[model samples]
Structures are given as structure tokens and as C-alpha cells.
Target chain A: EAEVAQSPRYKITEKSQAVAFWCDPISGHATLYWYRQILGQGPELLVQFQDESVVDDSQLPKDRFSAERLKGVDSTLKIQPAELGDSAMYLCASSLTGTGVSYEQYFGPGTRLTVT
Target chain B: TQLLEQSPQFLSIQEGENLTVYCNSSSVFSSLQWYRQEPGEGPVLLVTVVTGGEVKKLKRLTFQFGDARKDSSLHITAAQPGDTGLYLCARQGGSNYKLTFGKGTLLTVNP
Candidate 1:
């Protein structure tokens, strides 16, 4: 089965430094999502992209975080001047269709980020 | 967006024991999903319940969607050590079909 792929399974960074994580969704998937999972907490949506275009980012801290899916296949999430509270698991998910209740998302093995 | 609340935030049981976790919401869901996550890994989709009063079974696990579509439950029969993980309930809504998840129930089945 095809699976979403993420890079740098673990990362450690100093506060005020910059960090980036990458994700490649399963082929043919049009919708991609970025989520942050705090320890013992449910994952929260950071951004959603549809065919290289952003669909929703209201929950994203635009001042410090930015995500892009330039070609609509793979995506990158970046945080400049990372904060200690920013430490969490970064998950990437993809779905074949961008809409509907029937579509289920497939998740990648997330990147674990830690800020010191 | 809808908020999902999962009950029994943490559960520990011996192998062969059974347990149930619940998910509730004030807002109705068009559909709901259950996922399992091991430490250091992303959540993996287990089941999706679309209709109210729907029930689906996967191996030794059973999932039920309430008649009102505002709640769901997962029951594990004869749990095993392999069942140890985080159980999360999720729903998709909004114009973009954004997915929202509950805090999750952490289950540890001791051998």
C-alpha cells in the first residue's frame, strides 16, 4: 500500500532557531494536511492544502509558522525562531479527494520536534 | 469545527480483559473515525462510521456510532499487549472537510 512519507523522524533545535520538516503524500492525493500533536493531547490542524493551494490556515500561527505544497504533491512546514512550546509531533496526512465525509486520510510516520 | 470528548483518558488492563472508550460531541457529525497511534508514530485509521446506529467490527475490536450521531464507542474484546496505544476519535466537517480529533484514550494492556 502506498504511504505518506516524512523526513527527519526526530529533530532537536534551540529556541530562536529555524527548523523545517518535509512530507510527501501518497501519489494522486490532492488534499494534504499538517497537524501538531502535543504530548498526551490530540493533534491540531495547522494547515490544509488542496492541489498546491491553501484551503485553510486559520489555526496556523502565521507569525512564526508557514507551510507550502508548491507542486501539490509534497509539502514543507517551517518555523522560524522556534519556541519551547512549539515542541511536538508534526504529522502529515493525505486524502484522495479534498472533500466529502467518506474520504479517509492516511497519515505518515510523523516528525518529532523538540526545542530547547 | 466540532469538538470531540473522549472518556477514560487512561486505561490499564491485563491481557484478556475487555474495555470500552467513548467519544461524545455536542455537534452532530456527518461521519466519524477511530484511529490508533503507537508512541513516536502518527495515528493510523482504524474504522469510519458514517450512519447513525451503525456498527462495524474489525478483528477483535468493535465500533458503534450512536443513533443521534453525536457519540461513538469502541470496545476491545480480550485485549492483548499489542493493543497498547492511544485511541482517538475524529470527525470531519466544514467546507474543506477539515478533520478534528479528541484528546484520545491511552490504553495499556499488560501481558
Candidate 2:
């Protein structure tokens, strides 16, 4: 079966360093999302992209976090000068359309980032 | 902000037992979804309830959407070891494609 793909299943970085994670959504999916999950907590949305345009990023820490889906297929989420508090599982999900009401999201095995 | 709350943060039961997990919110959603996530892996969708008061069944699992679309429930009958995992409920937020997820119910079925 087709599934969302993510890279660097595990990452370890020091404080004040930069880190990046990548995701490739299922074929023909138009909506992509990035989320962060601390241990024992639910995943929280960070950014959302509808094709190549950002539809919701209000939850993203813009000062240090950035995400982009240039071709609307694969996406990259970057954190500049990462902090210890940034250690968490970064998940990527995609849906068939931009409207969440119509389709179910498919998630990829997340990148577990640990900032020391 | 719209938020979903899941009850019974953790559940441990013997095989053949019956259990139910709940998801509630103050905000109504256009649709609600249930997912199961195994350790070190992503969540997999189990069911989606769109209409109010809808009920869907998958094998030994039964899902119900509240009459007001603000709550949902998942019931499992004769649970087995394979049923152990984290159960999450997510809803589509207002006028947005982003999903608001509940903290989730961690279930451990002892065989």
C-alpha cells in the first residue's frame, strides 16, 4: 500500500544548531501538514500547506521554524538555532485535498529529533 | 481554540474484556476520525464519522458519533492482544484543513 514517506527517522542535535526534516506525501495528495509531539502528549499542528501555498501556520514558531513545499509534493521543515525544548517527534501527514472534511490524513513515521 | 478531550488516558484489560473510549469537545466538527498508532510508527486511520448520530462497525470495534457532532465513542468487544495501541480522535477545525487531535487513549490488552 502507498504511504507517506519521511527521512532521517532519528536526529540528534545540540542547542543553537540547525535541523531539517523532509516528507513526501502520498501520490496526488494536495494537502500537507507538519506536527510536533512531546512524549506522552498528543501531536500538535505546526504548519499546513495546500499544494505549494501555506494555508495555516499560525501555530508555527515563525521566528525559529520554517516549512516549505516548493512543488506541492515533498516538504521540508527546518528549525534554526534549535533549543532543548524543541526535542520531540516531528510528524508529516497528507490528505487527498485541502479541505479536511472530505479526506482522511495519512501519516508517515516521524523524525524523532533530540536537541541536547 | 477548539480542543478535543479523550477519556481514560490509559486502559489495561484482560483478553475477552470489553472497553470503550470517549472523545468530547465543545466545538462541533464537520467530521471526526479515529486512529490507531503503534510505537515508533505513525497513526493509521480506523474510521471516520461525518454525520451526527452515525455508527460504524469494524469487526469487534464499534464507533459512534454524538448526536450533536461534538463527541464520539469507540467500543471494543472481546478485546485481544492485537488491540493494544494508542487510540486518537481528531476533528477538522473550523474553516480549515488542519485537524485538532485529542490526547489519546493508551490501551493495553493482556492476553
Alpha-carbon RMSD of each model: 1.2, 1.6
lDDT of 1 by residue, B38-107 (tens): 9888899999999999999999999999999999999999999999999999997778887889999999
Give every collision pair in model 2.
none
Candidate 1: interface RMSD in Å?
A: 1.0
Query: Each candidate's TM vs. the true structure?
Result: 0.96, 0.94
Off by over 4 Å in 2: A98-101
For model 1, what is the alpha-carbon lDDT of residue A76?
Answer: 99
Clashes of 1: 0
lDDT of each: 0.93, 0.92
Among the numbered candidates, top DockQ falls to 1
lDDT per residue, candidate 2, A1-116, as tens digits?
99999999999999999999999999999989999988877889999888999989999999999999999889999999899999999999998874334577889999999999
Worst window of 10 by summed lDDT in candidate 2 chain A: A96-105
